[model samples]
Target: MRLLLVEDDHMIGEAVQELLRAESHAVDWVPDGNQADAALLAQRYDLVLLDLGLPGRDGLQVLRALRARHDRTPVLITTARDAVAQRVQGLDAGADDYLLKPYDLDELLARIRALARRAGGHSDEAYACGEVWLNPVTRQATLRGQPVQLSGREWAVLLPLLARPGAVLSRAQLEDKLYGWGEEISSNAVEVYIHGLRKKLGADVITTVRGLGYMLACQPAP
Candidate 1:
């Protein structure tokens, strides 16, 4: 999904951004609290990966502002080892998840997905649509009992559609959940990934709507 990453360490920031981009997420990376606050105030994003130690406004201040405004956007705080207490404070301040410094990219992405799954607090991690099964935690997909390995972006592309089952997601709507900062997107990148998913998941599984976006052939389990 499109996320705002507020981190200062250029190396870590760049590495994390690249990793998330490889997952096909559109990310907007900003350093310091001012840029982060402005972005939070002026725009909407699927999720926010916030670093607790920030210059100017401080991460807690930013979280407080967001909560005070009842923004309710899902925020995942990045904290340090000694600051375990800050994790609780961050959550209490309105963060949806927490990531300690020196975390695995896999863990970070999983944390992001877990929080986004709570966008409306829909916490079902395993989704089944027809013969397709997706594991958000592992980023694994299986169709008709066959394993499918998806690139990070491809997973980013497919998860939202799977999340909504049969709901139709327009290109722009889906794009909102598919990208991160400094990640290059092809005009047809989404299509390319979707096409690949269709091939692997079976053409009958994903249907296109002419000029519109695609939809998965899934119905929620009762």
Candidate 2:
């Protein structure tokens, strides 16, 4: 998923950003509230990891502003403020989840997965298209009940397609999912990954919409 990380501390932000990238998520990192607001305005993200004590504008203010504009992008607050009132304030200000500072990285990742699943309206951890099944949290894929290997880029490309089967995602949209800000994008990067996915999961597992783009094919392979 493409995510925006709003964090101030260099160490923490760098660590978290690398961790998310290792998990195959495309992340854009900003250090303060103003930058966060700007990023939000300029781009669409699957989720936002917000830090409450922010420079320029407060995190709560940023979140309130996002909600005020009726942007429903999920915000997960990660802050050092441990007070119950503070947590409540963050939630009331429109944070979808809150994580205290110095929390376990595993827990953080789990929360992200949970939020993604909820945002996609999926109650189950696994997503299916025809004979293919993907477990996002586990980063595992199976085809016809057998395990299949997929590269990190392949996993990234397949995720959004599985999240909303049958919905057409344009090449630009898929590229957005595969890359973060400032990352170089090749002309046919999406096609390369799509071709790789089809080779592993079966050609019929994904359908090309010609001029439109691509979508998960739910029909059984012939």
Candidate 3:
């Protein structure tokens, strides 16, 4: 999943970014609230990890602005403020979940997974298409019940395709899913990943739309 982390503390932000990247998530880390607001407005993210004590606007102000614009992107507040009133204010301002600073990293990741699942309307962690199955949390894939090895970039390309089988996604759309802010893209990165996926999952698993892009050959099982 792609995530935007709005945190001013370099230590906390870098730690969180590293953890999420280890879990195969593309993350864009920004310090200060104004940059956060601008990033929020500029790009799409699966989740936002916001810190309240921010430079040039504060997290609550950013949250309110997002809500005012009716942006329902799930937000998980990661702030040092622990007071009940502050928590209430944050939630009322439109935070989906709140985590106090000095919290458990495991819990933080769990919360992130929960918010992502909720946003995607997923009842289960596993995504399946025909004989291929992918567990995002585990960053694992299987074909016909056997384990299928996939690289980080390969998983990035495959996840969105698996999520919406049969729906054509343009190269630009897939690139958006594959790369995050400030990340450079190669000319044929999408095609390269698609070719790799086809080699592993089978040549017929992905259907090319020529000028349009690509789509999955399998639909979710009923």
Candidate 4:
């Protein structure tokens, strides 16, 4: 998934960004609320990791602005403010979840998975379409009851297509999910990954929508 991380502390930002990238997520990091707001305005993200104490506008103001604009992208507030009122304020201001500073990395990952599941409108930890199955946490995929090996980039490319089966995601959209800022993108990177996925998962697993792009093939009735 493509994620926007709003954080000012260099150490914390670096650590979290590294962790998320290791998990195959495309992440964009900004150090202040103004940059965060600008990033939000400029691109689409699957989720936003927001820090409450921000430099230009402060996190609450940023959250309020996002809601005022009616942007529904899920936001997870990560702040040092442990007060009850502050937590309530963050939630009421539009945060989907709150994590106090010094949070466990595992817990953070779990929360992210939960939020993603909710956003996708399903509660299953593993996403399945027809005979193919993928578990985000385990980073495991299987087809026809047999395990399939996939590279990191291949996993990243297949994830969104699996998450929303019928949605047609354009090449540009898939590229955004596969890479972050400053990362080099090959001209035919999406096509390469798609070919790899089709070869491994079966050509019929993903259908080309002519000029529209790609979508998971609808399963035939049993």
Candidate 5:
């Protein structure tokens, strides 16, 4: 998933970026609020990890502007201020979730996954469509409870499609999801990844809509 991290603290931003990247998430880190706004304007992120104590624009103002524009990309506030009122204010200001400073990477990741699931109205972290089941946090893949290993790129493509099932994701969309924007996309990259996914997860898991794109066909078993 693509993430936009808006944080002024250099150390914190670096740590978060490293962690998210290690988890196969593409992240764009910005120090101040203006840069954050610019980044948001440029790209559509799966999530935004925002810090309230930013240098120039301050986090609240950014959140306000985001809400004003009716942008619903999930925002998780990571700030040092831990007062109850401050938390309430941040929530009221449009934060989908809050994370106090001095938190663990695991917790933050859990919240991010939870937010993604909620934003997409998932019933559980273990997302399943037909016989395929995927656990994003654990990187676990299963077919009817039996483990199935998937390549990194395969997981990346499948996760995004699972995040919003039935949505036809074009090749360009999958390219961006597999490799971040501006990265070189080889002509056969998407097809190769899709072929690998089908080989491992079962051919019927992902359906190609002629020229429309790939969709995770959701249906009940007999």
Candidate 6:
């Protein structure tokens, strides 16, 4: 998944971005509210990690503008403010979730997974396709009860396919899930990852749509 991180604190921003990347998410980090606002307007992201305290504009202000513009992208606010009133204000301003500063990293990741699941219209953390099972929260995959390891990029490509079993995802759509700002984009990167996923998950599990892109092949149960 691709995420936008709005944080001014250098230490916090670096740590959070590193963690998200390690989880195989494409993340774009901005240091201030203005840049964050611009990025939000310009790019497509699966989720937004927002900080309440920001320069040039407050996080609530950005949230208000986003809502006013009818941008429904989920926003999770990370702030030091712990007052009930502040939390209410953030939620009322369109923030989807709130995480106080000094929170545990595990909790933060858990919240992210929850939001992603909701956004994807999934009722649970795991996505299943026939005999294959994928746990988005743990970033784990299994085939016919056997565990399968996937590289970060490979997982990125597979998630979208698994989200909607037989639906085809355009190459551009899959590419968006794999690359973010400052990362090199290879023309054949999506194809390479698809190949790797097929090799690991079994060739019959993924299908090429010829001119369209790719889809997960629908298979019958034994």
Q: Kindly report which residue pairs in candidate 6 clash with one another.
A: none
Candidate 2: tens digits of C-alpha lDDT, residues 86-179: 9999999889999999889999999999999999898989888778888988988998899999999899988888877779999999998888
Compose the digit string of candidate 1's lDDT tens values, residues 1-222: 788889989998899888877777778899899899999988798888899788988988998998899898889888674465767777888888887888888789788877877784577777777777888766778877789887776787787887787788888777677754444557887788888887777777777877788888766545
Q: List candidate 3 segments past 4 Å from native.
A: none
Give each prediction's root-mean-square deviation over alpha carbons: 2.5, 2.0, 1.5, 1.6, 2.1, 1.8
TM-score of candidate 3 on Cα atoms, chains taken together: 0.93
Q: Kindly report which residue pairs in candidate 3 clash with one another.
A: none
lDDT of each: 0.80, 0.91, 0.90, 0.91, 0.85, 0.91
Give the runs in model 2 whose Cα sits over 4 Å from its true position: 219-222
TM-score of each: 0.85, 0.95, 0.93, 0.94, 0.90, 0.94
How displaced is residue 2 in candidate 1, in Å? 2.1
Which residue pairs does candidate 2 place in steric collision?
none
Candidate 5 lDDT tens digits, 1-222: 888889888888889988887777777889999998888888898899999988889898899899899999999999999999999999999999999998999999999989988887775777777788888868899988899988777887888787667889998888766655455668998789899988887888889999889998775322
Residue 3 of model 6 has an lDDT of: 97
User: What lDDT is obtained when candidate 3 is compared to the true structure?
Assistant: 0.90
Residues forming the 10-long window of minimal summed lDDT in candidate 2: 213-222
* RMSD of candidate 4 to true structure, Å: 1.6
TM-score of 5: 0.90
Better of 1 and 3 by lDDT: 3
Please, what are the lDDT tens digits per residue for candidate 4 over residues 15-80? 999999888789999999999999999998999999989899899998999999999999999999
After the best TM-score superposition of candidate 4, give how far the Cα of residue 206 lies from its true spot, in angstroms. 1.6
Q: What total of clashing residue pairs does each candidate reach?
A: 13, 0, 0, 0, 0, 0
lDDT-better candidate, 2 vs 5: 2
Reference-based lDDT, residue 19, model 2: 95
